[model samples]
Target: MKSTDIFLEILGCPSEEMHEPVNAGYICPYTSDRCSKRGHGTNDPFPVCSIWKYTGARENRRKDRPVIVCPKRFYTADIVGDILEHVWVGPYERNKINAVREIKMGKIGNVDMVVCDTSNLPALDNFVSVELQAIDITGTVSDVYTSHLSQTDLIRSPKYNFNTANVHKRYLTQLIKKGYFHSTWRKKIVAVIQDVLFESIRERVRFAATNPKDENTSIVFMSYTLDPTETDEEGYYRLKLKEVVGTEHSVLMNAVVYETPPSKDLFVAAIKRQL
Candidate 1:
């Protein structure tokens, strides 16, 4: 089916076949901006809302424009599957989370959806276990990251959160500490520390959390390489971090760090890399 049709379905709204605009189908003249906002205050007859505006944008825009919607069914299943099947990597998930706020303020980005899951979280005793399980799976990295850290307060405010407890150096210091995860960089590298130096992975992961409630929440991170030939084994997938921003401190930060691996094929060479 067409993407618009799918989007309408995911939203649980009537398709155009209903022969009426979404606003027409509902009672009261709810403008697109007055219906979709999250959270609430004293009920207003019509305070500008977030959800209403988004849905209205979809339902009220020019029909002749190129279809910007993904197949609606994409929303029904786990987001990780869709990411692997579609969407390019690099800050896409982070961008989606940020875009939500932008939408509320009438600012928009290319991000289409925001995802969350609880399996990607790191435990105080077994952070590597979470990381290994995540590496083994093939779904949306953002979903997996959210799942693992579901219990952590960081998820509440991704914009400001990191694995490290400190906010001032949340992104940069922690990035250096994680070795970029699966990367080959030197100098207490952050992300690849799990793969490169397993002994301190726990400390590094925690150091990256911006506001770690328990020792289990992970600061969302990923790794990638610019060399097309670097491949998975060579540590091409870069690390990224995510959390909600403003309300509680979660913020998705992608700093585009550069790292030169000691060896090109580091992560791939480990036969027993499994968690």
Candidate 2:
């Protein structure tokens, strides 16, 4: 099936019902932590499975407000590792893959996750740095709309869309810096993002693919969503990851050199105050 059709089908389905436990023997794919029956927003110490929580509550409500929770936490590194093992890399070789979470690289900061082929250890080329970015889907509607208008009217706009601008600054920029640091190693970086930032992400990818640059970087974009039809024993939605854009060498190379303004301190501080 077409990627667009899959995206629409997943989005149209109710988030809570997307993944339902077929039997009592199914296991939670996210983590090994024991699953609890407590609903979200309670003070219960036991952690509930993410699939059991309501991911589309904002969509169902009349307020149109953004969900404050981070979606990345729901789809943790282990889950990402499983997806990469079974889907991107063949399951036969999945045993060779090792996933490490929150590993700090010198100067580049703590990356969300890193996947490496254990058989090829000490070879940086075998390592893939993964970054997870989940933006507030409903919160930046006005900004996204404005960005679309500017694009259609041929107006000069900012380098990144307001909604995902921070993601570019915080995550993608760090990947570029790491690429320069490990230029000889030729490590690959993958950025996994939610589908809500699709248009903004495509714009960034198009700009990068068309532009010429000197950095020999390899980056990939993986878009993920909850599977509408299946779930685990914990009744959490299954995740589906797809390569949406920027898997080409030309795109990755140019994308790494895209100019990023050093306004993170100010921007982050402002956002924190608002929160």
Candidate 3:
């Protein structure tokens, strides 16, 4: 591990200016509450929105790549608000649409949020379920976090790897299942994810969503990339929407089930190397 392996891209609320986490806490832009998500064994909220990784010369000479680690990182702006325009259906005004957070359907797993058509008072139908997913880290970085917050140099560098495959194996399955479930209800499901995470899916999963306006599109993915050069008045980097993919529930199912497999001997060759 090297000292440059990890960089905290965001410490507190992504919308606010960077500040020390010792005295006061920064309110989570998503929750509008004290940042509740924490690292292991820490009482106070561990407000790490995202991180930048520097892989050694083998991967690249040296390049800084940002990866969002927290779902709240997607909340610097109303993602669903933007999603509404992309996936909106019916005659209701987009402004009148309400974004509902955290609704659990029996055995379907909890949805992070859903966009509702609030035009009809006391009724919340024609809703679209939304899920926010970030990458799961493969290695520990708490030690790195402690040092960064303390404003001290690392005693020893800690390396962390993004578990992109984990997303494909577990998370994508859940998303497809949820997508199918929503399709049964004749509704739409949207997944908000980072660009890097989506790239991993593009590698392993076959997806070809041509038009967003297609009524057949029951599953929508809106991917964003962190814009380093652009920032709000508070100096927090902007999450620019990079791409939107629209597909049917059945399309997603077939894509995942029929993903192109690698050459048969590729794994065996690697095993031979070990032998």
Residues 28-75, candidate 3, lDDT per residue (tens digit)?
A: 765767777678777877777777756666656455677888887787
Q: In model 3, which range of ten residues has the least summed lDDT?
A: 10-19
Rank by lDDT (best first)? 3, 2, 1
For model 2, name the residue pairs that clash.
Answer: 51-236, 51-237
Clash count of each predicted structure:
69, 2, 0
Q: Candidate 1 on 1-275: residue-level lDDT in tens?
A: 12222122112232222222233432222123323321123232211100100222334733221111112211222234333222222332332221111111022222233332223334211111111100111111232122222322222311111122232243334333332331221111112111112222333333233322222223332221111122233222212222210101122122223223357467666644764
Stretches of candidate 2 exceeding 4 Å from the true structure: 1-71, 74-92, 120-125, 136-162, 208-217, 227-230, 247-275
Best model per TM-score: 3
For candidate 2, lDDT tens digit of each residue in 1-275? 11121112111122222222323222333433333333234333212122111233334622221221244344532444544643243232567877787898876587777877676557634566777766532222223223322333323322211346666556555655654554446555666665545455566644443111123445556666545467545554455554444444444446546545569999999999999
Better of 1 and 2 by TM-score: 2
Give each model's whole-structure lDDT: 0.23, 0.45, 0.75
Cα RMSD (angstroms) for every candidate in the order listed? 21.9, 13.2, 3.2
TM-score of each: 0.18, 0.50, 0.86
Model 2 sits at a Cα RMSD from the real structure of 13.2
